[model samples]
Target: MESPSDAPASAPSGTTPGLMGPATILPRCATGIEGLDNILEGGIPRGNMVLVAGSVGTGKTTLSLEFLVRGAERGERSLFISVTEASSKLIQNLSTFEFFRRDLIEQGSLVFVDLPVIYDRLGLGEEELTGEEIDILIRTIRDLVRSLGAQRLVLDSLTSVCYRIRKDEQIRDFMLRLGQELNELGCTSLLVSEIGPNPARYSLHGVEEAIVDGVILLWNTRRFGDILRVVQIVKMRGTSHSRAQYVLELTPIGILMAPHLKGGREGGP
Candidate 1:
């Protein structure tokens, strides 16, 4: 978690301007995650790719699901592309949440795609993704976005894909192409990535941080004999965001985040 003091001054000079200057305010898409929008000064920039990187059990999946579910409630079509979990299992896990609605899925307002199913269809084996394989993956995503007219998208666990790509340059190229495709399709995306415990790096390959428009890091830290979950807006290009870490909680309703208070910690029951 970055301290608020670490953030670049919004008004560095009266004359000299910065990315957060008055003329550079980008359009925002409200995430509907409690306290998160407030921290982001409304929401993430529209059409921007955001990386939700974290270790296991840090609420990355829940957070992404809640984002799609909230968008569905607003009549915005959303697509969830799962690389690790099957669509059935994903839905089953999220079924207990109050925000989860069968009607949304039935209406096709919320759609899910299992990447492994696509992989099998393409006959891709357990090897590094060649240029052709990467192209196939990107095309599949593009076709889904167009067919559904998806306004928001979530790619759950890009870490799985990273494992299949052996080269750093290949991963970087894939991300660049994928980001461009999503932007052109006008879909705001959340790319979930699994990071290792106590990571000095925010992403699996250390390349995603540079490819996306924003990086939101989630992690757990032991404090006073209790494991505390924290959410931090590591970097949000062309947007003003809170640099301080916030305590995150996963409830029956959805995930909630709040500013971390001095000498106190917060977590789910």
Candidate 2:
């Protein structure tokens, strides 16, 4: 069994003999999303906690859902923990995507869980979660992941959960413990962060972005009188990646990306 750690296994030593280079290449969890994998130079390092931050309608949820679907198709158990939306409604919306396969859910490879159910079961009904309550929450999440043998997970709208925690210290501690648990379980996770059109920080508490291993920021920009969706890799640890902004498209088949033409002004959703 993997030991609990705050981050993924450290990169190989520079002096290590290898045909690829000085160090052996790190293992990646391919997202299977068109341009995203390219931007990530294959995909995110396994066991990373990436923040998918964006305003409303920028496709944060769509991108995350696709990640889970692709993982499940690859025989990896995937889980979706919905905080702000109903799983049934999410399934309804997912049906429109051509790449989505309902059979994955039926086969038990993909699972959809509502956060409220966990909260109720744990008796975490207060507006603010106490320190002990937060510990319970983290333990429950870890237990669920372990029970499902999940290799990939998504927490839709992490901002909603942070709102209840309120204090920055607690929020930071929560993320740290939760991330460690997931990393130890070998689960690559995406925590959706809902922000405004132009935000100073990617997360609600401004501390979450610092705790995660990566940040993928999405937004809408106006170019030639048309609003185009844009994606940029603000930060990714444990591996090198392209930080350039790209144009993103949401279609029935799935998301597509192209290099941004530039000269576009930022716009609100």
Candidate 3:
């Protein structure tokens, strides 16, 4: 791993060394993923809205699931709002992971809800949501988080949700209010962003990334005749973390990461 000095030299005073090697000023909501937490300094600062941006097959959903599962293991109530897949199918896929505990769902520590179901119930049937409808959507999410007392939340793909929110201004306002609602409830959130490879921006609407508290970017690249998944912290609000890129692996146990060293066999799987 790279040294902590590789982080920003302007890190604020009174920030303490975190679980890994970096420093943070606020309480952390640890993802508990090997190497990732290390890169995050410890974990995401509590109540932060982090954008997990990546192209397809870049392990975005897997990483988000692992984040929720790990949080649930620590006795934190976790919620997953799936936009593309059914909750049952997600749980079925999650069962293959060694670290996954099905009982966590049965025990109600981890909960999954389909965003489509919520939309249907809320009567947000239009392709483009009105500003008033956007408020309803945000309130619905806030209510779910509050009712579940979810300490950690994951939205499978923010792109899917934003597709219905066409205007950049509306998307920005929605994110701002939703983030404020979650932060007020003490919930740390991961909002997945599906983008084309090498996107100019991390989200469907460029403004989505700006409203977020942090951005963890993932993408695929060719290296030594092999395709590799790479991850990096593009931005994080309250922590001094490594901006270095790392190789990401999606394993049966869970997500793993290692520093992306050029021509080094040690990091890549």
Candidate 4:
């Protein structure tokens, strides 16, 4: 995890960076989104695993994919761990995004590990994954992360790993272990979660939220019978950020942020 006051990747001043190397500054990866990066104090701290939580259809996948693409554009190795989607279908779905680059996938700058391959071996259903299965799954995940030299990792949804074991205690332990392991690898990570009816809360009713370094909540507020979609940064350890929710839209250009420029002056808490 990055220290609370770690210099932003795009540090504003021209002062020498506090990197360990003699005059060699630390490398920072830029997330492609403009307003989102500003909210992150210039992007998620390098080498920390973050959790993005929301109900189904809450742009979790879209946000994560964009993070991977942003890192790839900056020449940082990236990897996506698909706990639910198939390798082919995963690629097919992301292929529709104009921001997604095929060469990045072909050249190994970005790679995806399909958990279903192992889940099928254990016979776990789509929503059911077991601790025994996860133990087996972790080995494969660890191997792939090393082989690809990935610096950015995304678990499409940690909820699969949570329910696989069928016990909340086991899920908590798994989340802690996963968070610790990801930190040791020095890879920036994002874990997705499916929220419940209480959309205002940041975490699911489990341990995934407790272990993550930061948490982002994607939102859709129904006001005056109108559905307004938004994304907000709820918790980011060691950094200061705007708690307001920014109106969000998905377009051919990519995900758009509606801040003050939109018809609303305020966002979310």
Candidate 5:
């Protein structure tokens, strides 16, 4: 893995000369959140699977939506795969945000697919995902990406999928394979997960952290009698990122994260 600074200053074509010599530096995919990209240096390593772990009300979905919306604004096709909510409901919820554009959806620049609907389409019932079932799911997602030419993807709430798998090894295998498939499709992805109250765990299962290229933890802390949303970059491979916990704010337009201030818990919206 090449550090951001070690990456090539310029690339002529297929193979770019870097500090590592004759290596290709993957481009960065901006998350579209204010100040967050700067903290990440430029953006996440392109085609890397990133885990966005947070408990409820931590603005996990909002942040993921903003990532896709921002990518769409940049003319990058984005796909949101929802395992927890219907497409209509998700769209309805995002309707209030200034970044939520119905025109993008209409234009097919942004797309939403419910996982349950895909399962039903494939004639698979609600049960533990076997090897065959997992393959089908991966194929379905890959097909979607290929068809839409998607550059960014968000699998909202991977925790929901983990619940259906019975064995820990199966979950690990599933995540590994899923990440590889997504990477092969040349898409930067966010695997959103609902973390438990335990701050030590990055995801529902401990397997997710090891499978992804990055892990971002979002949580709320009580500071001076106010609930302050905080974001921490636990790990990001191939790029140097700020590890400090920053203040996260949900504004009318989108999320704005700033460095934590001393005794200023009431500053964020």
Candidate 6:
């Protein structure tokens, strides 16, 4: 397997990566988030959705943000929808991450939406979506995607939508509709999911993992009084990726996936 940096710096014209190199499609944009795109073969398929699952403080949001912001840097507009968070609060929290800034969010390149407000105003129970409601919700999202011509998208925690709506059927139906909508609109989306503590059983019911084209699991463990982070390519549909769980770190530079196994916990205060 070629190192990410070693792969050809260009994206293929269309349809696939070098034909048989991997089952997953190579990324058109280098996420700017480290080691991730490598295990993902190149990156998540151009318009496909991926669920980034992990526990609290595991960096799922940060990674997703980096992915979207990186897209902006590449001249691709991006969108970030937080169903459970207020937009102002979400932006404030992200501002402290390595590569986040208000300037980017206000520049029309990285648009943020507070879905919690929308849902609250609608009084929509978890899983309470009727066919009619879904139609409107999708249309709104599509409007945002089209208006921005967004090439990348991030949903802070899609599974929470299940909790808020309290219905699996609705979640499933909405996701199916949303996924197709995103694909048709050419938005590469990262759906953040809060995983259980165990690294193996990261996703809640595996639906999120199953629905998307790829799944990246992030885990953290304490060793010698230091927190060590690890990321694994649980699955990627179109590319041949490294099966190993590599070390990851969140430093002043954002998320970094160290492929070399560097033998332990990353240093930071």
lDDT of each: 0.82, 0.86, 0.85, 0.71, 0.81, 0.70
Candidate with maximal TM-score: 2
TM-score of each: 0.88, 0.90, 0.89, 0.81, 0.88, 0.81
Give lDDT tens digits, candidate 2, residues 1-269: 33121123433222122344324346678787858877676678789999999999899999999999988888889999999899999999999999999999999999999999889988889498899999998999999999999999999979999989988999999999999999999899999999999899999989999999999999988766888899999998866778888889998888999988755654333
lDDT per residue, candidate 5, 1-269, as tens digits?
32222224443223334364424344677777757777776678788999999988998999999999888887889999999889899999899898789999999989999988888999978988887887788788888998889889999878998888778888888888888888887788999989765557787778889989999888877765988888888899866677877988988889988887756444321
RMSD of candidates 1 onward, in order? 7.0, 4.7, 6.0, 5.2, 5.3, 5.6
When summed lDDT is taken over every stretch of 10 residues in candidate 5, the lowest stretch is 1-10
Over 4 Å off in model 6, which ranges? 1-27, 120-127, 165-167, 199-201, 224-226, 260-269
Candidate 4 Cα deviation (angstroms), residue 177: 1.7
Error of 6 at 134 (Å): 3.3
Give the C-alpha lDDT of model 6: 0.70
TM-score, cand. 1:
0.88
Quote the lDDT for 53 in model 2.
Answer: 98
- Model 2 CA deviation exceeding 4 Å by range: 1-22, 263-269
lDDT of 3: 0.85
The candidate with the higher TM-score, 3 or 5, is 3
How many residue pairs clash per model? 0, 0, 0, 3, 0, 13
Clashes of 4: 3
lDDT of 3 by residue, 110-179 (tens): 9999999988998888588899889998999999999999989999889999998998888989999999
Ranking by TM-score: 2, 3, 1, 5, 4, 6
For model 4, how does the per-residue alpha-carbon lDDT over 14-50 read when each residue is reduced to its tens digit?
3332353233223334466776776665666666678
Off by over 4 Å in 3: 1-24, 263-269
